[model samples]
Target chain A: MSTFSKTRPPLLETTRPTADQTVLRVTDLTTGFRRGATTTEVVRGVSFDLRAGRTLVLLGESGCGKSVTARSLMRLTPERAVIGGSVQLGDEELLTLPLADVVRRRGKRIALVPQDPAGALSPLRKIGSQVSEVLRVHGIVGTRQERTGRTLELLDRVGIPDPQRVAGSYAHELSGGMRQRVAIAIAVACDPEVLIADEPTTALDVTVQAQILELFQDLQARLGMATLLVTHDVGVAERMADEIAVMYAGRIVESGLAETVLSAPRHPYTAALLRALPVPGVRRGELQPIPGQPSAPSERPAGCPFRTRCDFQHDACSEYEPPLFVTDVATHAACDLMRPSQQAVG
Target chain B: MAAPEFLLEGRGLTVTYGNGVRAVSDVDLTVRHGEIVGLVGESGCGKSSLANTVLRMVKPQSGTLSFNGKDLLAMHGDELKAVRRSLQVVPQDPSTSLNPRLTIAQSVEFNLKVHGWGRRERRARVMEMLDRVGIPASYSTRYPHQLSGGQLQRVAIARALVTDPSLVVCDEAVSALDKSVQAQILNLLAQLQRDLDVAFLFVSHDLTVVEHVSDRVLVMYLGRIVEEGPATEILTAPRHPYTQALLASIPTRGQQRAAIHGEPPSPVNPPSGCGFRTRCPYAVDACAGYDNTPHAVGPDHAARCVRLDDLALTAPQAWRNS
Candidate 1:
């Protein structure tokens, strides 16, 4: 009998947060874009700690400021976006760093794999030149010969077939999966301490997405680097993250261990989201949809940003914003109903 | 159960594009009167091309397609137009489907207008469909840009059903919406299917979504139907190796995951014999030959695999919990 989908050993293992060294710490990050004379805040007071070899996933749907928060960490948002936050990378304050200093540290210290590999890559340059450019900028290799050899090595490591042929071809010539592999090769050329991938697998097909996600997992296991992944896919978060921060309306409504947050989400928004997704073996009529569209930053109310669609509504929710209340061990939820004082009543 | 009456039947459908890409090859499918038939496949597998064939949007190079026992390929002019009225489509993106210049009411009314409904009757029917889909009458005046994705999808559904079509083809209808919002649209489609008793050709790349909504499912791989059976049996105990691999590759809430390497091969130069032979882990020497025989595993379940009888594959524990 074929044992293809049987309960054999897992093909890819989910790495626990084994390393204790805190690599990157972000505190109260707020990002806003200039609209006329006023600034429209997109990311509001987002904070997280990324330990070495751990994956911290910023999870949210569209317009939830998850992407904006990821961009704010690297100062990669558009020119008009005003970022106010303290990003600490191994005793270095990245938010206050000079432009040139940040540029020097981009590939050498932290790397980003964007959502769209096509947009991230240069259409005119060959794939080899792009990988070599990263290595050269970071001063990884001295000679041109070493750079070419290392370029091909990086491509091959990322699971690209026929590195020689792929290196000579332009970005537009490869498939979406191949372009993404080239993008991964470029991002990891310098072996950065911290990696930030924003929706990296959202653009590819399911089979290719599995391969790319496995590449990320394998690289993180081998190199022992910290990853800050931002995505809207629950399946990716379930498979990849050590810790997950559920973002809603520019703030983290829930943060906890990935297993806890996904299986027993405390926040109303978090629970609602899990209920909405279609799962195999789920009995019909169990899909309870969240009532309304996610509110835009401009339309968000003063109190709980998620109260409009939340199933459990309290009168105090309209008066003040809820703080992050500890709901369980290693889990926090920003819900008034989950407060310690109201535990018995609730 | 007694034999079900077929609403649409397609046999030996094959489509070769201008660039000689074999998109849909020798696929046979059927949809009952009010049943939801889900067509599942990944990108480059020609699921969309096969969907287009069923939609009558493309004339296959060699095939016979009939709807309501009427030969679809032989129709011309007024006959095709009359048949076209019954074959409605809901595309992947609602933002692109609805006209930005037209109001929501007019967008839905356009279908009725094309069917030659009177002015007064068109307005009344448009309002009726809008309310049935749970869109407020106040929203009918707003333009497409003003509505949300879920609302716009409801409008698209309303537009499709306003013609009282026999079959509605929804191609990736909920793939664009956020997961939370995607639920609302799926529930809406199921509700409409029950209320209207209309046959729906639900095409999506996600098996999780299809598992609950579909009465029967057709698993396509590399321009062929690898498995066709009841949704429960196909999703839980798929006999085809390709279907098993497809299910395993999806990272789920379960603890297990099987990494299937490589993307789908290019359709322009498909491999010989079994289209999935290149990726099948259990591929045998016999898989290299074209026997083109479907082995039946159950009363109404079948898979086109040479090693179907030798496979005891079950879906992941998460998929078999219930």
Candidate 2:
């Protein structure tokens, strides 16, 4: 009965986007980086779609290619990164866009609210000035005074107390929760169609974490923007996501409605994730952890990425990669055990 | 009933830095022999500061600390050294606390050697402690960097326990490990407490891990304990507004979500009356004028809110749902 694990509802309901609207469409996405003489394929054959106003969570452990997938979508891929994929933001082919165009697209078409807010916000600059700088870079506001006024408004919108005073305070002056609020305000300043939050509240305390998650839920409704929340915490995924895509290595092991996936997960990895939740009332030390560490990009196994750790893995699972199979129109799982005929697809 | 045999006690302890930065207020805590007391709070809640104070790394500005009837604050010279040898710490970050150059066994045995134990005795004790922490003794010759986060933490605990310290302070100890690893370490700590009768000062922001291990919980804010009680009672029916908000904010399995708005107030220039009143939803004008002093609200339950009249001491709706 620790005070830290109590659950709270998402502050709002999911926005009902028109059924035909697809905010993001990613297909056959592959990315790799060179280490000395060898090129390591970090993310291989990744594909998923995010709908307007819906939360599509990329769930996985550290280095499971979750962050790489989100980064590729924004074309924020590093110079060391070599990417091949089809990433379409609405009608625009994001992967094929020019470098200059991609720069323009950042914070305008799509924005990222990074993992560690304390690190993401510049330590040297005042929070308000840092937010205004985003507006200035995007050329959204013409004058400095206008941008300052807008920054104060943004601070107020994010629930910062004494907006004027906070505007003049440096990042060090704010707490972790306040810094996260500043980061959120910056991400939404351009009114982007998509907001990608990478472990936004992982480092925060429970109460502070709840407040930040509520902020995202509130913004998603008011702005009608598609949100991609990336986290490893299943409890967080349950409270925040409209749709969940459980990632393993570099592939989506399971993708389905949040309720369906959480309540009755099909993929082994998804099931393990749900079972691993340290639910109170369940005897302690009974948490069934997903067995092994995620595979390294250079050390990609021959067949199904999860076979080494999967309890139900069979001989065939080590010979060929399992294809993502549709269980329903809206639910898909890439697992040999979940869908035995998965190999027959494509 | 006889009072529980306490291994360590901090009575009216206070630690203050220059510029009037009071890190630990008049705090009282007891770690019963063979029991774990969870000092749970967010960053800057003085959990670390209090731990350092107990270790005598940072001298307290006021109050007394004792271990097994020995006055920790008054002990000096060789007496202090003996006290230090008996009360050890398993710090949160293994990467920083451990020496890279020394092998795990050497690191552990160094403590024994400092206490003037013979080389053979050191080796035997090192192996025994390693086995106790669930680390294979064969891996002892490997350097600290060769170990995983979980393994390194075990080594850290083994090193602390080698000298047979009665009280061990774990500052955010298991927070660095992965979820499964956290469970294993917590289980290991609990098992060690049961078998060895070691008292633990468990400091962490992770409530799940804390509840799983701690017998009693202390909720700290701005260097003061807002509430202290049995884990189940505090978790189920938190009487303080700050405690309620903290409980409501976490996303636990089976619990309903109660989203708190805004972040906690700045500790440096904390608000008048209750430090939590600025963001508290139930705050009235009376709360604005309330003194920043602790008041008893229930048996073993205390809060610093001025709105006890208007304060709806209700169980967090989130927990009820769970």
Candidate 3:
């Protein structure tokens, strides 16, 4: 065990770089789907900044608009959907880019590591060719020889043991973990400035999931690319995120550094979510699951969306939606309980 | 002294699929009355096959399965159907398992009606079971689509328990749910187990969940039981390398653990001797030649490792502290 641990490269850098450079900035991004007269807003004014060479994890349960927010950044919404807000990647505003320009910039400057590795790859194509397709489309390499050489290099970089043999095999022939490694290889093939991974490891076993996460950390350090990861698992967020943003009912309720938000959550929903997880040591029946389900976009409450299920709800919490209150230098929470007057009332 | 009563028992259980792939090898498992036995393993490790075999959903190639001292494998026709009333299963996905067209009440009373119960008794028992699972009696009139995932799972639990089975098999029952909803369903299962004294064969890939709910835990690897002991002991002081690696793989709050390398070997062509030798960091030269057998490490604690006596294995710090 000691030999393996010593021989293996360090999974992640102990000290995060203090560069503090913002790579992707999203401001008041709202996405809504229109059907006839009713327009249901799925992502309501979500905002965050992703630092270069760091990860910002959007944590939420299903239907909380975390996935929609990620998709909106890439302009991947449906034709009928209405998108409002500015997504600035470096100096370019992605939302205002033309269709041809966005398509060019997609694989060239930004890439997506999607969930469902099994379905993400084309079943008809071999793994090596699929990875090479990215290189060809992005014009990362000029010659076919260069593409093949780069594909093997990328596969090897993602920690595939037998890259030569694996590249010849189809997606179905590889295991789930190996297929995910192939997907990551393709996503990083172009060395995109920003990588958006949506539940990349959710389908894998625990052991394989850890490996994929470690691979992401190593690649982020080596490539210095910003990563925006969206996952429903708190443990995944705890392990991967430099910054954490808690989303509920189509809005971010808390945003801050991972250690701050996880250790001392300000919002009731965030605290409840942490408490609800069945961590090892917590006895059975001691877990306090939040009482109610998240409200649907169409049935969102008038004030705070989480007021229906919050344990620390007050009369003022139902009167108006609270804007994010800056709790510390870098932490903020959108909850009435953050106010001194509310604390006094209690 | 007389042995403690076991609600479900299996000896030398072996199951092989049509492709000549042995999904489950000769294994022995027992569940006492009102106890929860958790089966944990990676996907394709044969945990599901063992669960399905015990439920009698799949016929075993060889085994002795007895539920309540009656031979389960020998029963057929009406006798099998009669015995099925005492064995129930709660599947992973509630939405797919339930008939979308049927109302919640109808789905809950399905087994009761199938067993030739009177309409009044079925209705009464459905209402009672629904209330027991924390669902309001009125929601029974609504279809499954009208309820949330957590509510639908409660309905599934209600349907399973309505027949009052002595043993229930939960195959990844809460894996589909959100964290909050998963906790609710787990708590509901624990509460129901205490209130009804029903034995549960809880099968899941999530180790933390299995630890919380199970009295005894069984770890499977490549169609064999690698470890079995009390949940606390197996989780905290794992004897097998596979179990230690699994316990360490979990991404906890503050601990850093080396991820286990390589995927599990294929069940179609598993390695000789120790099934876990391919990925285990502690595999030795002797591991390739030793036959698979459980070595007793302590009281009620056993592991399928040849070097169990020599190795000093401890779980990760997070698990030990937890």
Candidate 4:
């Protein structure tokens, strides 16, 4: 039996919190793209909740549908992409909302911190005005002068020195850490309830990366805003996440509190990912590489998506795709290894 | 016992760009025979310049670089050409390092042919290098685009080793790959070092990766060596303030991280005394005019900081008095 099954039934309360307390909620969300006559699924039945004052890390390698899931929450997926299922913000269903309404709520209710800070900010515009544009558009500030004043304050809050000078400088004038802090300033300008940071530190140096992460942690604690951190590095997840979701082939193979999932991962895919990481103390030449690349969205398998690379794959793994079965309401894994001996208890 | 013989020793090395921009300064480093020495610093710190100078890729304005008994800067023509073959460089991007049109085998064999090896001998040496790097002979026909990033890097490494160079400089050679691929390449490099006995001059900004691959570590700043010592001792208990900060700033796997507050100072006009004084949290008035010279802090532990004498004081007090 899984660890959660030993706990009492009342502790297994699966009643998800209401919308305001729960910053973002997704259910049976499926997203895909159509090529001529065929539809290729990129993200299938992905569900998770980002509540206020907690970090929900989407951990996966490239093409594991982590980004797709994040983009879907904002309805930022392209027109050619087909999206289904319900995404709720508090009580309102976002998936059914009009495009115009979605755009209105984009920066006001939720803000996105994209992967590349250097590419995200316009090169021609001064750093201060770019931040002011968001406040001006949302009518958050009355006058242009007031917007500039607020921009300086936000810059200082994100750890930039000489905010007035930084405000006048262009994107190229700033370093990588300074640029990322500017991006965070832009995201947190409107004081949104949810912030989605996608691989924000992937391109930075190690020292700068640690500073950026520490900044995020400090901001999260101060603002008490829910955060969705998307990264492929297990180390990044370990440092930032309160809860973790391990995605494989466009599905969450495991999800639980970060400490539990990280220290005691149950799924084979989760175990493989943890083993693949090159930790500092570990010897250099003794890497345990997970053989074979993750299957692409266009060429996924018929049964279990990870069967081809899974070390413990059985015949049943190919014959049937296991449903996401919960050992308790808090933790779940979609694998035959976790399949109970008896028919799943209702 | 006498000191282990260093295959390459660089003392008082200095490189200055035009307009009074010093790219490197009185840097001292050594890579011993059958050992790997890692030189780590962030972008613009001149680690790459140091490695390139060893290969004579960039001529230094001053300093002495000696491989065995010969001074590198003093060599020219045939002597320089012979030295270039003895030291090979594996650049950051393998795709750009290798000629896209050439096949894997032809790429490795080119160096042998340039050194005046006969056609038959070149082919045999190319095959041997290919096998050593774990690439099959059949892959000899494949172009750069056909191979994965990992495979491309292997081909780059094999090509560098084809001439049987005694010293190899890998500048972020495996930084571009995924974690698993990075592990595999590191393991391969370590195995190759053991089997081939070729000394490595490794340069990267990632401390964890550097610590894993290096026997000795050298921490560089703007354009100078701030600290140098055995890898484990330096990484575990760094004597220099900059080195300590660098190690403290790294976010290890599954460990909580402490904040690194400020950015590195611009290198164009580095501060007087020590180049790292501006960012060294333990800076004082004396640090502004202190002599910039390497001093012994412990056995093999050396740093170019003024506060090395007062280790018993509180952090803030040390900073005030440094």
- Tens-place lDDT per residue, model 4, B1-322, is 5543778988888887776767788788788888898889988888888888778887788778888767878899988888878888888888887898899788888888878889988898899999998898899999998787778899999989988888999998878876666766788889899999998988988876787888888998888888898887776677888787776665543445453467777767678887777766688988989788889978877888888888532111111000
Question: What TM-score would chain B receive for each of the candidates shown?
Answer: 0.95, 0.90, 0.96, 0.92
How would you encode candidate 2's per-residue C-alpha lDDT over A1-346 as one tens digit per residue?
A: 1223223212223333453368888898998887778778878889878887788888887777889889988878788888897988878898888978877988976999998888888888888889998877877666777779888988888878788998999988788888888999899887777889988888887887887787787787777788899998876887888888888888888888887877777787777766655554344555666654556676668889888878878988888887877764347888775564543462
Off by over 4 Å in 1: A1-18, A344-346, B1-4, B253-257, B318-322
lDDT of 1 by residue, A33-117 (tens): 9999989898888889998888999999999999999878788889999999789988899999997898898976799999999
Q: Report iRMS values in order.
A: 2.7, 3.7, 2.4, 7.2
DockQ of 2: 0.30
DockQ, in order, for the candidates? 0.52, 0.30, 0.56, 0.35
Give the candidates in order of DockQ, highest first. Answer: 3, 1, 4, 2
**Regions more than 4 Å wrong, model 3:** A1-19, A328-330, A340-346, B1-4, B254-257, B319-322
Candidate 4: tens digits of C-alpha lDDT, residues A252-285: 9899988778777778788877776655544566
Candidate 4 achieves a global lDDT of: 0.81
TM-score of 1: 0.95
lDDT of 1: 0.86
Off by over 4 Å in 4: A1-20, A33-40, A78-80, A298-302, A325-330, A342-346, B1-4, B252-257, B312-322
**Model 3 chain A — which ten-residue stretch has the worst lDDT?**
A1-10
